[model samples]
Target: MAADPGPTHPPQHPVLVVGGPTASGKSGLALALADRADGVVINADSMQVYADLRVITARPSPADEAAAPHALYGIVPASMRMSAARWRQRALAEIDAAHAAGRLPIVVGGTGLYLRSLMQGLSDIPDIPADVRQAAMDLQAAIGSPALHARLASIDPVTAARLHPTDSQRLIRAWEVMQATGRPISAWQADPPRDVPAHLSFTTLVVEPPRAVLYARCDRRFLAMLEQGAEQEVAALLGQKLDPALPAMKALGVPEIAALIEGRMDRATATATAQQLTRNYAKRQMTWFRNQMPAALRLDAMELASGTAFTKFYDRIMADMTKNITKMG
Candidate 1:
């Protein structure tokens, strides 16, 4: 995705990235690929990176591990914020181990930033000055999104334009960037992009199902989670008083689930809210990949098993990798 032309030669080590929105069968597909190749599955999702979120985050289930080797799930603790740069280094090590053991590495999850970092080396954006970051965080903690946006509007309105009025974290980040660099964050991004080596040969799938059908699936999955102790999981995390700014606290179901816990909403209302948020997130995801990750092979989930889509899909990926390896030989 970077300006980098990428490797002229085929990657010596092969890897596969299986991605789609939540409840779109990404984990299932990763399991299938890993089973076929006797491979290791690595996590490429931001939420799944946290250890406290096994049930809530819908991380790889125990059955998934029994089906194939998996790395990087439930490793980071609840208190930390992980970035894509950290994940890429960890996944690269897992990829090396898989190859040495003659096992495949199937990277899976739906975080766009994670996949992009894997394919294009992350920009080494330096840390913002502590004073700047603290100022933004303090402002966010005090006056919230609108107030933060006012500050950003004065300095980096170009960057602020891309941020939704409710997108507090991003607005804070832009403000921090402005304070530290004295330049609009948008202007800084205009430089030619860096080329991080795309280390693995990969086949990516973008699962785009009919909106109605996918929405139904999201509702069903949320209800299924309710049956699976999702409420209890929310109660547990709420016990910790994690900062509202923390990513886990802001997962699709968290606020809704919290309301359920507080008796402000009934089970049905909370679950419905969660489902609506999930569907909206999926729509945003599809849009993002359409423009940002055009290389991903789009697959319609409506006719998943019985169509030329899946057949040609598998064949094209295999053939491309096979041709690359043969040429390498």
Candidate 2:
């Protein structure tokens, strides 16, 4: 007999993250990778976590879930606000469970904040007092996001410049943090507390499709959502009379569909408006992933959507994982 040969590759990391902009075929790639790795597919998309807006959010369908175990999709009621901290706790539990069961954990979504919280941990800003939060809310209600953002710019230009003028939630958060801690939120984020355990390693892949191609997909996907009962989904959610301020109520396409349902807009107008918003959102997401995950593997989503290309991509991922593990060892 020939001499015994050593193993060819190192041990694989326990966690794999697939992230990108919307309509970048992340879900499909995650599903395929989970199947190949005997992994559980976990949701990291903020919108997809709400139970009420499945159709509008483009959550994985039942047929897809039937093919592999999926965690964290549609698990939270729309009435409840699921923060990134809350999601990180749930995701950690799921990851541990998957590991104990000898399965890989494949977390997939387009939510950059959630992924960031998991990988780099969250900022250690002190919790804002309820009174302080209420005060910030009052200020925002009185002056609006742009005016409040201008105020924030005076106090914390770094955070203000990073947030969009219309991003009310983050603006208010920055304002509240400053009020409570006498420090800018950006100052706190300069140092993050480790959330994930030190033992775990992650292999992150970011899908980057061409901007024009991604925009086209976003438009077509939104239209498909409408065709696949998105209107009814929105109507049902609106009927629940949940607070209009709820995050789920603000999901992409929900407001447009609700407007159509209420006769405030025609279907064509609603669809066009929603498509434009979706494309803009995808553009922002692409920029964020590009800036934040500089070291992550970058794959063109257009290629990954094709069968042959996806096979090559998967093989590359496996090889890279082995190489990463070897280096770490």
Q: Global lDDT of each model?
A: 0.76, 0.87
Clashing pairs in 2: none
Query: Model 2, range 119-165, lDDT digits (tens) per residue?
Result: 87888777679899888878887888899999999999999988878
Query: What are the per-residue Cα lDDT tens digits for candidate 1 across 1-329?
Result: 56987647645556777778777877876776577567799988888888877877788789878778889998887777776667878888888889889987888888887887787666546678778877887889899888788778888778777666666667877888777877776776665446555455665667777778777888888887788888888898889988877777777787898999999999888877888888888876767777777877776655546546656666676776666556553
Backbone clash total for model 1 is: 1
Candidate 2 all-Cα RMSD: 4.9
Report the lDDT of model 2 for residue 195: 57
Where in model 2 is the C-alpha error above 4 Å? 1-13, 305-308
Worst 10 residues of 2 by lDDT: 6-15
Compare the candidates by TM-score and give the number of the best one.
2
The count of residue-pair clashes in candidate 2 stands at 0
**Residue 181 C-alpha lDDT in model 2:** 96
